[model samples]
Target: MAHDALRDELATLTTEAADAALDDIDLVPTLEAARRMNAADRSVPAAIEPCLPAVAEAADRIAAAFARGGRLVYVGAGTPGRLGVLDASECPPTFGTDPSQVVGVIAGGDVALTTAVEGAEDDEAAAVHDLDALGLTADDVVVGISASGRTPYVLAAIREARRRSATTVSVACNAGSAAGRLADIAIDVVVGPEFIAGSTRLKAGTAQKLVCNMLTTLAMVRRHKTYGNRMVDVRATNEKLVARAFSLVQDVTGAPDAEVSAALEACDGEVKTAIAMLLTGVSADVARSRLAEADGSLRAVL
Candidate 1:
């Protein structure tokens, strides 16, 4: 009876529905299989188009929370969990945000990121425990991600977050899922069924990734983490980034390479500060002070 019930639930999931068009996928040649997979992937963006309004609204809520000194938190399990962690981890280097500003809570902890934690997604109690440990508050924004839109761990986290009065957003691949109903904003991309049937890590994963990317990127943009099209808040932590920093400074300021290098050094390798100094022909101290006065907006400082 339990097996039958589980089978029935799976059959109702959009992510689990078998695609009759790809019925002969296993028997196809390598090139044909690749082409078929690519064709399926192409529909992901279209599926997300209708969800733009919801995604933008969620981003605005997150940016407001950031302004109020609250954090953006992502909760999930399995592939959804890994995607949350991946996006959170990139915030610091990409937008120069503090590590604590964007947090990822995956069921079974960090260990679940690489290898599957058996039965982790089914533990609702563990989800509450994980979220509770984060010191959640009303100012925080919690994003719940689940391809099937019914992961117990993800739903539990959203519930706990809502209990704490935190703003909640849900990203799922199905319309009218429980997680979506529970969230303040529901971003249902509805990327249809997977090519391999029940393999959400394929099309569903792509839609989730695009939505997650938009949320964080737009939030950062709202917070002045970018100037025009440039990632002005980028942290130059390595050889490649350091080179890119010099390139960005020169491109934005139209200063000589040597002048850009000097400005960067004077500003302690801060890209936005260096740009301000070069553009305003001001001392590094004045540039830094002006940046602070303008709330770190490089455009205002220039």
Candidate 2:
């Protein structure tokens, strides 16, 4: 069979390669194999340790852009793409960010999120098309993700972002990947060999998810999305969250439940505003102004 350029390189690797060892193992018991895989997975965090500084730097850049009204965009394919979308989608409910503020671009568009699209990742032009649709600018931050570190679609997106003077970062499992070379800041967490041999969804996926979580969560934290450790800016859309809002008010002010309830009502169930009202003993309007001045960070006002 004629191998694809990407697969050609992948096929040349021995068991020594990070993603090929699993196929060679047969003597181990099923339970033991699973246990070993679990144990091996712990090394993923350690693999990422060296890149924390880079990750933090990227977070700083992203936070600065977002503070200035720029968007954070995540682009990828397969598992990496899905993870990007997951992180971006959570920003709204978690930090009360607008849907457009954080966006995710998959190779085959939204459809690829659920099902694989044939040759979708190979189309470099599609990457630019997606970025163009978003009206990308220098104020934006584009993050490209790929486990093998050689996906054309991801590389194209990063290159396009950089060409437009946008801050570009690439997250990959393999070192020296093309995507890494093109990014302004490249994060390569080498989680050495997959348990299932070339199945990046295992350890590689775990590392990527961890990094993605840090990238966005830390950016939000830097932007004053939380008060102390509590998610003060969380959007209360459901019963559990509404209850959480009341609890947060009580926790921040150490006030009686009745007073907390009153503050929440006054602020229309906005946790940050409710906390500000309870602590400052001011009207909701005044509390809102103070919170706004504080960048919606509850701890800042206190």
Candidate 3:
């Protein structure tokens, strides 16, 4: 009385799934296999090149919304989710952006960030709930990350975001994915079959991370977070960052360390203002005004 129908359905579902059985392969050659895996990773960037236009478009839209005081929200599951959270968390110290300006929403919430959540990615309704919790509006930008591009949670999140009139971008490894279709902009970096087959954390994850870096970094650059290629807006929260700020000021204005220190003191340790004061030979207040007029871009005022 075996359930043949259920057995067949399970088999069909797993038919194309990547085989995790590598035990039969010779044990001593495993290091060679890992090397080959690393070699395969090199193709990920090439795969992502064609999608740069789409990625850039998304970045431009994100910058616009951000300039208008909208938030940038990242939604994903598993590794992709963790990557989004990591990127969002770094924005504050890296670009001096408010923590609330960038947000990360994982499928199973905070706990899932550290541990796997059974069936969390299958919860379609949960995505809507997460968006609701954020009070998403038309001014927001939502980026959904999913290697397979079929995760119900991510797809539903992007769909809901779009319905709310928010800008939605989908980052995926597979072409023609549901996540892509549901988003306003789709960046599909087809890195081919994974080295371990379907183990997307290898190639797909790398591509997603790279794209995420580009998206956020380029947006910050557009927002004038950098001045003359230096992170002028960086939050000098530690001794290391304070030293970095001093070095950046000295490098930008060709001033001695003593002058840099004086300028920093005048600007209350604000790197951008200090650089402005040093380069423009003005008081801190006048330097602040010049920087404000140039939208905090050193290149513009210099």
**Residues 1-302, candidate 1, lDDT per residue (tens digit)?**
99999889878888888889999988989999999999999999999999999999999999999999999999999999999999999999999999999998898888998999999999999989887888999999999999988999999989999999999999999988889999999998898889889899999999989999999999999999999879988999999999988988888889988899899999888999999988888999998899889988888777
Q: Each model's TM-score?
A: 0.98, 0.94, 0.91
Candidate 2 vs candidate 3: the TM-score winner is 2
The total number of steric clashes, by the backbone 3 Å criterion, in model 1 comes to: 0
Query: In model 3, which residue pairs have backbone atoms overlapping below 3 Å?
Result: none
Clash pairs for candidate 1: none
What TM-score should be assigned to candidate 3? 0.91
Ranking by TM-score: 1, 2, 3
Alpha-carbon lDDT, every model = 0.93, 0.88, 0.87
* Model 3 agreement with the true structure over 182-245: per-residue lDDT tens digits: 8999998888766665577888899999999999999999998997578998888999999999
Model 3, C-alpha of 275: deviation from truth (Å): 0.5
* Per-residue alpha-carbon lDDT of candidate 2 for residues 1-302, written as tens digits (9 for 90 to 100): 54685567775432126444455457878887787788989899999999999999999999999989999999999999999999999999898889999998999988998899999989999999999999999999999999988888999999899899999999998877667889999998888777877788888899999999999999999999987688888899999988887787788789998898888888788888888887778999998888788777678777
Write down the lDDT that model 2 would get.
0.88
Lowest lDDT sum, 10 consecutive residues, model 3, at 9-18
Query: Best by TM-score, which number?
Result: 1
